[model samples]
Target: MKRVYNFNAGPAALPKQVLHRAQEELLDFQDTGMSVMELSHRSKEYEKVHQKAATLLQELLQIPNDYEILFMQGGASLQFSAIPLNFLPSDKTANYSLSGSWSEKALKEAQKIGSTHTSSTAKETGYSTIPSQLTLSTDAAYLHITSNNTIFGTQWWEFPSTPSYIPLIADMSSDILSRTINVEDFSLIYAGAQKNLGPSGVTVVIIKKELLEQCPSNIPTMLNYQTHAKNKSLYNTPPTFSIYMLSLVLDWVAEQGGIEAMERINKEKAELLYETIDQSEGFYIGHAEKDARSHMNVTFNLPSEELTSNFLIQAKEEGFVGLGGHRMVGGCRASIYNAVPLESCQALADFMKSFQAKNR
Candidate 1:
């Protein structure tokens, strides 16, 4: 079987080993006579799969004992509202740094729930750069930041500091497990699994125990972080198949080494593509500045719209998929998520070089 170089931003490529493992167990999971997708989340067999995924995630992240790992639904977008509903107290302001499209949406959702302060913004740059520093208020309930801007292809090398006592929340959907992070630096972190984790149906949340304890009451049971924490993310069925796949993916990651190892490989992959763009000598123009370039998604443009169109068409003919950019901006994007092999990146870089040579 052949596989194309897959660079879709979300609902993206998954590790082939994870896919194969799922295929092997799809008919009978752990000697059970039922598929994992068909099992009741309450079943003992399914529970093992569910718990193992959480355990692997905890081990991989080296998450602090004080943080509660949750597997929730409704994607990270749901957390946009749920976060404010649970943590943004009526008397306090939620501080936000307007970094990109997702953060803008999160800020908009928070504005509807309670008072919000825009501490900093990069709107002037079309969301191509992150704010170097932010001015968060001590009275703020939570300071929210999007660690990686998926659409604009920019990311924070380091987060801006907030007031010491204030909780720092981040929507790290695109870059969740792509690197090593000091989990303690965040009071809460949420990510949609489609990018780096597993699949679209699962959303992973890591929240400080104190923060979960502080989650306000009267919010809908499903929308409340405390409810999920109390229920161990089994308040409802949870995504059994997706969690199973995530467990396999985590195993693959561990086999490759831990997050530091993943980060190193990701760095190498990103540099290959970025170097291709930079060396194109005006044949390609990158959307983000060098320092802010994302290690996951690399966005750029060809010399002309026609060349861009032909490049995509040719790339597809050569077995590349999802090389197009987000709709908000019309360009090219190559999302080199963890599942994408370094050899694939090398091939793409080679393709880019050849494409430029023939066209130029």
Candidate 2:
């Protein structure tokens, strides 16, 4: 069966090779006579899959042994509360740079749990760019930032410089493994597996071991990072199938020359799409500023709302799904995650030019 050029944000495209390997392992994972889905989390077969995934992830991200990688449920959203619950006492405050909707939501969740402050926010600019000229508080419990804003199509090219004492927490849900990152920079990093990893059932949390000591014992057991870290992410029944699929995806990533290769191709793919929009003159307009543009999700708009609607219809006809921006900001968006092939971006760019030529 032919596959459409997938651009859906989360639960997005995974590598074709990974899919094939999963298919092969479905009936018998290492000749266990059972699918990984059917394997018990405690079983030796599943344990190996889980451990290998962790090891591959550590190698891919260059995560030091000081960091504890926990695969838990509840997506990255749950971490919004979990983060504040663990660190932010009601009397103290946590600082955030509100760059996009996700960070805004994270700030709100933190407020509900305890006091929170925004070092900076780009809401006044319609979230079109990352906020600059920030004032950060070193005394705050932690400084939270969304690494990439999927909806707004802006990304923090480089993190703001903060004191070593201030723990930097990042919501890397959308752009986690799409590029190479200095993992040591963060005190905590969390991402949903759906985007750059595998499916939606699991959320990966990487926390420096020292931060776990900061978590108060009053918080819920499941929300505490120390709980899962101590138990090796087996505190309860884990998302076995999702972790297995994630292992396969990591294997594909390593085989494809690791994250550096992914970054090179991802940069090229994004540039091709953005360059198409740039060359369109007045016909197509990009949403984010050039300096803050995101490589994973590209947002653009045609000359008119009518043309934007028409563009979606045409893109669909050309086997491009999930091009519609989002309900909040109605325009056009293309989420070109790691698994999105450069050929797909090229095809979409061609479609855009053709549509512009005919309509302009």
lDDT of each model, Cα atoms only? 0.91, 0.92
lDDT of 1 at 127: 79
Highest lDDT against the true fold, candidate: 2
| Candidate 1 per-residue C-alpha lDDT over 46-104 given as tens digits, one digit per residue, 9 for 90 to 100 | 88988999999999999978999999999999999999999999889999998889999
The parts of candidate 1 lying over 4 Å away from their true place are: none
lDDT, candidate 2, 1-360, per-residue tens: 999999998889989998998898889889889999999899998899999999999999999999999999999999998999998876678999999989989998888887778999899989998998778764688899999999999999999767888889999999988899999999999998999999999999999999999989887899988899999999999999999999999999999899999999999999999999899996889999999999999998887889999999989998999999988898999999999999999999999999999999
What would you estimate as the lDDT of candidate 2? 0.92
Alpha-carbon RMSD to native, per candidate:
1.0, 0.9
The residue ranges of model 2 lying beyond 4 angstroms of the native Cα positions read none
- The TM-score of predicted model 2 comes to 0.99
List TM-score per model, in order: 0.98, 0.99
Candidate 1 to truth, TM: 0.98
